[model samples]
Target: MFTNLLAFHSIFRWLVLAALFATCILFVYKHFTNKILSLKDYRFLQVVCLILNIQFILGVLLFSKSQLALLFWDNFQETVKLRQPRFFGLEHPSMMILGILLFNCFTFKIRNKINTKEAFTYFSKRFILILIIILSSIPWSFSPLTHRPNYRSLELTNF
Candidate 1:
């Protein structure tokens, strides 16, 4: 079950990333082109928000079941000495939660704005902020502290 959840969480990240990128590009286009915000733009934001929420829930579940997370909780001092465990147990989750909070706050502020141009401008800035947060929080392959998963090794039969 844990492995299945882990695999799902890993694979789902692509969806979240794609949605975020799409939203960012759309916001950038709107801002530079002076295009009025459309219903499609609102829908795209909604989709990205929903994806982030789902990813957060999945991450929490995975964290609870992760042995690395358990070790960190059991012995913070010792766990922090190891980079991978520490990143998984604390840094990743903390930054992700922070990203989520920023995403929500920015989206809420954008929704409250009555002017289309004002909302577009607000979204452009906030989306870039959220994108940076998300990008930084990700455990990319080149990171010495963490490595990307091998999709081929994620066999369902192992679960």
Candidate 2:
């Protein structure tokens, strides 16, 4: 069950990224073209926010059930000394939560503003910032600080 959850979480990251990217592009196009914010645009934003919320829940479940997290708690000092454990135990989760908070803040701000142009401008900036945070927090293949599942095998391989 844990392995399945992990695999689902890993693959879902791509969907989050894709949705965010699409929303950002759409916002940019609409802003530049002087298009008014429509219901579709708002729906897109809501979907992206919903996806992030789901990812957060999955991450919390993984964190609680993970053996690595248990190890980190057992050996707090030593775990903090290592890159991979530190990233998983602290960095990744913290950054992801922070990104979600930022997204929520900007999303509410966008929703409240009556001016369409201003809302789009705010969304563009917020989306770009959130994307940066998400990208940085992700455990990319080349990242020495963290580890991720192997895409080819779809197995929960160790870092």
Q: What is the C-alpha RMSD of each candidate to the true structure, in Å?
A: 1.9, 3.4
The digit string of per-residue lDDT tens for model 2 on 62-93 reads: 99988877788789988889787778888889
Highest TM-score against the true fold, candidate: 1
lDDT to native, each model: 0.81, 0.81
TM-score of 2: 0.88
* Residue 155 alpha-carbon offset, candidate 1, angstroms: 3.7
Q: Please identify model 2 stretches exceeding 4 Å from their true place.
A: 150-159
lDDT of 1 at 114: 37
Model 1 backbone overlap count: 0
**What are the models' TM-scores?**
0.90, 0.88
